[model samples]
Target: MNTFFHIWKYPILLALLTMFGLLAALIGTGVWHVLSWITLTIPAIVCIRFGMFPKNK
Candidate 1:
């Protein structure tokens, strides 16, 4: 259980954030758009960071 959480925690969190961002963009009005952008940007930034500078192993 510990190992599972250790490996899956960030992925799960990012997935949830991405879902929220999508829903916010679809269903929300003013402030929600900004919120959606912020939430969505987090995962994109993570991906870009990893893609550009992956750990060498």
Candidate 2:
């Protein structure tokens, strides 16, 4: 149980889950292009918002 929780910890798990959701939306769509774009863009925005790239201080 501890190992399972460790594997599903935040950051990695969140990113992985978002990636899976995006892939699912892309591959499993019929008229949900907007939703797919939103899903993909949200993670990117989150990364950017949280300073994914380190800045020189």
Candidate 3:
């Protein structure tokens, strides 16, 4: 259970962020759009960070 949570944590967070961003963009204006952009960019930033500087194992 602990291992499962540990492994799935970031992915779940990213997925939730993506969902919120999409919903925010679809359902509102002004500040919501900005919020959506920020939320949406977080996952992309995480991906780019991991992709560009992976851990050496």
Candidate 4:
């Protein structure tokens, strides 16, 4: 994780996601639908992995 940020940084990823989302919204077609679906899943997976995990109690 550290190495990834060190090399590329978060803003790059954010920009890419934002661009894809904008493209998806403006052009709601076949390939764009698939691309946006795959792109949006990133946040869903992150939320499940980091927020919805079972914690030791």
| Tens digits of lDDT, candidate 2, 3-53 | 867766766756775776677676777646556676567677767967876
Give the higher-TM-score candidate: 2 or 3. Answer: 3
Q: Output the number of the lDDT-best candidate.
A: 1
Winner on TM-score (1 vs 4): 1
Error (Å) of candidate 2 at residue 47 is 1.1
Cα-based RMSD of candidate 4? 4.6
Question: lDDT tens string, model 1, 7-55?
Answer: 9999999999999999998997899999999999999999999999997
Ten contiguous residues with the weakest lDDT in model 3: 48-57
lDDT of 2: 0.69
lDDT of each: 0.96, 0.69, 0.96, 0.74
User: On residues 1-57, what C-alpha lDDT tens digit does candidate 3 reach at each position?
Assistant: 699998999899999999999999899999999999999999999989889999786
> Best TM-score goes to which candidate?
3
Clashing pairs in 2: none
TM-score of 3: 0.91
lDDT of 2 at 6: 73
Measured on C-alpha atoms, candidate 3 has an lDDT of: 0.96
Candidate 4: residue 11 Cα off by (Å):
6.1
TM-score of each model, paired residue for residue: 0.90, 0.44, 0.91, 0.56
* Clash pairs detected, candidate 3: none
